[model samples]
Target: MALLPTTAQAAQTHPDPRPLTGQEIIHDPTVARLKSGGYVAYSTGGIIGARLSADGRHWDDAGNAFAEPPAWWYEYNDKADPWAPDLSYRDGRYWLYYAVSSWGSNHSAIGVATSPSGRPGTWTDHGKVFSSERTDSWNAIDPAIVRADGRLWMSFGSYWTGIRMVELDPVTGKTVPGAAVHHLATRPDAPYAVEGPYIVKHGRHYYLFASYDACCSGVNSTYKIKVGRSASATGPYVDSAGTPMLNGGGDLVLEGHGRFIGTGGQSVFRDKGKDWLAYHYYDAEDDGTPKLGLNRLSWTKDGWPKVS
Candidate 1:
């Protein structure tokens, strides 16, 4: 016989154990699945190589992806900031959009490169996709692309204002001129910022997920992830609680302290009949250095999603 049915034992338990901390440095994680059934993550810290994992945990670094900086990188001398990178598969090619710029400002541009295979040593720079003008009001960075309803869309920006989206030609991987780019979301009232736009589709709606608050500067950072949804690809998205994301309507999706902190710059992927959220977060115990974090996402009956 066993003693059971105590009040504490019968109560609802939080799914997460205490927050995880003390991880090695890993930032700006980009996830891709190989044909060989393994996963690859390309991250920051001069780490241009792939991290191979058969089960998405326990990884081995495959060395730097690029042996030398391509001639086109203007600030290649200062190689610290690799920033946000978006990876996609199109026309038997693997396309990567990466940013090299000063953090949190528009003194930057997004560059495009492609590879015949998803492996390293095969990338060819396609040139800059978009850059910021000194006179412009918004910061141009963090390029995320997706195909919806037979159209290609790229969403990008930082705390300077909010996230914006523009139409793209699926064939050329370039912006479609005269395309109506519009604001998708922002947070003027929040403490500091809204940035890192990662968009995806679910059911009849398109969802835009972004990180908020200060991302750098260690334990003082207030970084977290929030989300908004809309019925159209170019959105006036709303949060789960029915607030307008365009009007700063967003609901908290994930935050940090115990296992993760400053968790944002996310990408969503579907694998093995399940959805996974891949993002970077600062390790709590390692003096707030950023690292890769993976979580499983599930949908509610009402169509909203949560990480489990």
Candidate 2:
């Protein structure tokens, strides 16, 4: 892939591009374009770090969502550093789904919180929605949600068993009882390290985007984004080459290039009449400080998503 830049973005001469200048730095972030005509992103850190952008190009630190760490977080992660939050506006309230866990441990949990206004320190933690233990085959950390056909579904996982999905109750934002768990994608080889799955439907297909390889190790990070698609929300997703995602199939959507190392943990949203891919990348030159990454998406005539 040529890694085309968005038409409206300022042109830069790097072979592997970096986001435009200004106050931009984040990791495992999700963007929400507020009705106020600004962008708000929640990333991993203190109650999940927040930043606001008046123009979506320049940002300033907002604050964390929680005034203090929630009581239950210590059971999952004492650091209270919530990870990978998926933010969305639901039922007139802002819904935030975040993960809690210590490093390299399957003892993790995914929690939910709601706020009338989607601003930092305004969230009311609702507590754990799902969790997993070391004995479990899947590590339940990174979380992403999508509303499909009036049903809510969560896609999450990390090392140990790859990505998995469970249907959510739209009203309560919890798992639907008796819902079948779907094991969607995994890398079979050693270092089996696929995580962070986000789903979006365009046309008739539900596209599954997941981060592949390791993350969180700064410049040594090997993370990249890959994708597959299915006709149904409960997927049997296959890559462009027609291999089932269950068998390790995923076509590359974006990867590390030049000074931008470990580009992954992506979220997609349509705003201002254009589709965009929001993610994070390590700045190799900045001693691997994770920074926000945004790239507009343009679909091919045949319906495949390509980074613009």
TM-score of each: 0.88, 0.93
The per-candidate count of clashes, in order, stands at: 5, 2
lDDT of 2 by residue, 134-210 (tens): 98888888899998998899999887779999999988898888877789998878557899999999999999999
- Give me the overall lDDT of model 2: 0.88
Model 2 TM-score is: 0.93
Off by over 4 Å in 1: 1-24, 47-49, 75-80, 190-192
Best by TM-score: 2
Q: Estimate every model's Cα lDDT from 0 to 1.
A: 0.74, 0.88
- lDDT per residue (tens digit) for residues 98-149 in model 1: 7767754577777778887766666777877777765765667888887888
